[model samples]
Structure formats: structure tokens, C-alpha cells
Target: MNCEKIKESVSIRTVLESFNLLPAKENRKTAFYFALDREEKIPSLSVDFVKNKAFDFGTGKSYDVISIVQQINKCSVSDALKYLHKFDLSVLEKESVAEIDYSKNYEIIQVGNVRHPALVQYLKSRKVFEQRHLVKELVYRFNGRKFFGIGFLNDSGGYEIRNKYTKICLGQKDVTWIKNGCNTNNEVIIFEGFFDYLTYRMIEKEENSIPDHLILNSTAMLFKVKDKLKVYHKISLFFDNDHNGRDTKKMIQDDHDNVEDCSLLYIDFKDLNEWFCNFIEKL
Candidate 1:
């Protein structure tokens, strides 16, 4: 297909998903995706499904299907057009146009302490049962069915709900920042998720030595706490040992002078929690 025809036929979502990129936050008409060009804490790529186009708020650039492919793949116009040809336009169009009813997606049933046997076991399996107080038992309903998970509350009052079988969010997605009492600490420790933060607490023997904690809930939330992080004299990162984690760690380092990458401590494992679980298994 020609470039113009391809742009009109294929949705930007299809092109983005082809690169394994998903929306960070989305509504029916518009979705925010992580920027293609750089590592960031907040998603700045705004996609308009109706227009089949995207705008990078970070870079102040605009893209259609063809240009987006070119930007992500760094390919020529000819190659981008060839890549676009692989998509079945009819199916993509259907998916792109469908409206999601966010109001009915999920309902919060209860928020209480961690008492469920299954949830307790789940936490134990991760070697973080002692840190259970940091999270809550979230009972929610979705699609006419009831479900429950270990819920970590974020700054925006959303819950990072996790179970052995499921991982999801209920409400607005944001970071969870736990300040030391009276903001007395000059140092801060950053974690990519609540589990990792709990793992750090589990391994650290000295309770008083632990610094202020910021559970990003997602690396995408790093942007939300950038200014907050600047106040600390030392910033230690406990991100996962993966591409996204490493990228975010580097971004933090670039932005701050006293940054430390603590993932090297568990370099062989996927994350701090995984390393802790393996350590417990060995014991």
C-alpha cells in the first residue's frame, strides 16, 4: 500500500503494539503511551484513535502511522510502508474504534488488612509476609465476578492489585511515596514496584537505617517524583534487572548527581523480590 493509503488504513495503536508498546493510561478516544525516543517516567505520547495520529508532548512532534513506524523502527519511508502492509487493516480498524466503558470496568468491594489465606500465602511465597502491613487486602468486582488481591495504595488513591494469577490496577495509576517521619532523612530509596520496596525492607536488618521510600508502582511514574527526588542528598534505585529498569535507572542518574544503581546487588535475578525468594529457598 502507498504511504497515504497505509496511514489512512492502519491505526497508530496497531503500529505501537507491533513494537510491544502499550498505553500507560487511556480512555476511549485518547491514550497516552511512553515516548518512543527516550526513557521517561510519565507517558507523553498522546494517541488520538479517531484521527489515527499521535503527538509526542515531550518532543513536540507529530506522527501518523507511517511516521510513527519510521520513528520507532528508524527505517526509510519504503521500509515503513512495507512494514505497514503486514497488518490486517480491517481488524485493526475495528479494535481502534471500539470504545471502552471505564466506569464499569471494575468496582472496589472492600479495602482491609491482609487476612486472606491465599493472599497471605502469596506474600509468604515472595518472602515478604512480614512486610504485609505495607499493603492491604483489596476485594474488587470485575465483569460480574468477585476477585481479591494484595493491594498497594499509590499517591492518587489507586491500588496496585496483585495476586498469583492476576496483576491489575483499580483507580487512577500513580506513584506511592512514603516519607520518613517529619521528612527528616536526606536520603531516599526508589523502587520500581511495591514488591521490590517490600523486599528491600525485608532484607535490611536495621529499621532505623532505612531511608525514605518511593514505590514508583511503575517506572512510568518516575517522572511524577522527579522534583521530589531532587531534595535528597542520595538516591538509591532498586529497579528490576531488565531493559526498562536499567533505562529508568540511567534516566534518574542523568537527572541527579547522587544517584546509585542498586540493581547490581541482585544482577542475576529479575528483581529484588525474586532474589529474596531465591535466597529464602536456599535457606
Candidate 2:
């Protein structure tokens, strides 16, 4: 299919879902997703179902169905068209008008210390059981069903909820910044997720002093704090070893003079947690 024909036929929602990128917020007319090009705390990629297009408020960039695929996959126009050709017209029609309920409405049933055996085992599996105090046990009800998980609170009063089978945000998605109780510290270490932050804590438990920590929770949030990060003298990034992680690390390096990419410590693994687990196995 030609680019024009594909753009006219496919819905932007279908393309996003095809990549497993769900909207963080949606209503009848429009939905918001994390920017396709970056990690973010809030969903700024405004998708208009009727227009069959998306706009990234973060970057002031607009995308058609074709361009959306190209931007997301980092592919050429021809490649994007080939990827879109796989979508049947019937599927496109169905997706164009389909109502996607992205509401994560839930009530907190309880929030307390991490004590459940399953949750404890989960922490142990990650080799962060001693760091369990840093997280909470969350019980919440969603769609009339009860569920529980280990919850790490963020700066925005939201929980980065995780379990053996699930990983989700239970409130506003935001970064988690942890100060080391010293006002003069100019160095801060950035992590891609909470577990990586916890892994660092586990590895450095004996250290009398440590730099401040910032957990992006999602790389899209990097933009929200890029200006704030300049206050630090030294920035250490412990992001994943994948494409997005590399991109984010490079972005920080480009913007700051004292930034360091510490992913080399876990160069063979996908992330620090994976490397820590393997290290534990060896011992």
C-alpha cells in the first residue's frame, strides 16, 4: 500500500496499540500517550481518533499515521508503509471507531509495610529484601476486583506498582527523587525504574555516603526534569542497555557536561536488576 492510502486507511490508535503503546488517558474524542520519541511522566502525545493523527505537545511535533510509525520505529517512509500494509481495512475501520477505556480507576484498600510472603519473596528474588522498607504493600480494588502488589511511591503521590505478573502505575506517573539528607550534595544518580534504584541501594548498603537518587520511572519524564538536573555538578545515569535507554543517556550527555553513563557496569544485561540477579546467582 502507498503511504497516502495507508494514512487514509489506518487509525493512529491501531498503530500505537500494534506497538503495545496504550494511552495513559483517554476520553471519547482524544487520547494521550507518552511521547513516541521519549519517556515522560505525563502522556503528552495527543491522539485524535477522528483526525487519525497525533501531536506531541512536548516537542510540538505532529504525526500522521505513516509518520507516527516512522517516528516510533525509527524507520523510513517505505518501511513504515510496509508495516502498515499488514493491517486489514476491516481492522482499521473497527479500530478507528473503537472505544478504548484506559481508565485505571481504583480505590486504595490498604497501604502498609511490605510483609506479604509473596511480596517478600518477590523482593528476595530481586535481591532487595533488605530494602523492602523503601516500598509499601498496596491493596487496591479495580473493576470490583481486589489486587495487591509492592508499591513504590513517587514524588507525585503515585505508586509504581509491581508484582510477579504486573507492572503499572497506581497514581499520577512521576519521577521519584530521593535526597541523601544532605543539602550540599551536588551529585545525583538517575535510574530508569524503582527496582534499579533499589538494586543500587542493595549494592551500596555499606557506603557511609551516597549521592542523591532520581528515578525517572519512565524516560518520557526526562524532559520534565532536564532543566532541574542542571543544578547538580555530577549526574550518573544507570539506564537500561536497550535503544531507548541509550537514547535517553545520550540526551543527558548532550545537555550536561558532567553526566556519566553507568550502564557499562551491566553492559551484558538488559538492566541493573538483571545484572544484580545474575551476580547473586554466582555467589
Local accuracy of candidate 1 as per-residue lDDT tens digits, 112-211: 9998766775797788999998899988876665667899988888888886645566778899888866445588888999899888888787654557
Candidate 2 is scored at a TM of 0.63
lDDT of 2: 0.83
Question: Deviation in angstroms for 157 in model 2?
Answer: 0.7
What digit string (tens of lDDT, one per residue) describes model 2 on residues 179-210?
A: 88774658899999999999998887554556
Give the C-alpha lDDT of model 1: 0.81
Candidate number achieving the greatest TM-score relative to the actual structure: 2
N/CA/C clash count, model 2: 5
TM-score on alpha carbons, each prediction: 0.62, 0.63
Mark the regions of model 1 whose C-alpha exceeds 4 Å error after superposition: 1-104, 182-185, 207-210
Error of 1 at 201 (Å): 1.3
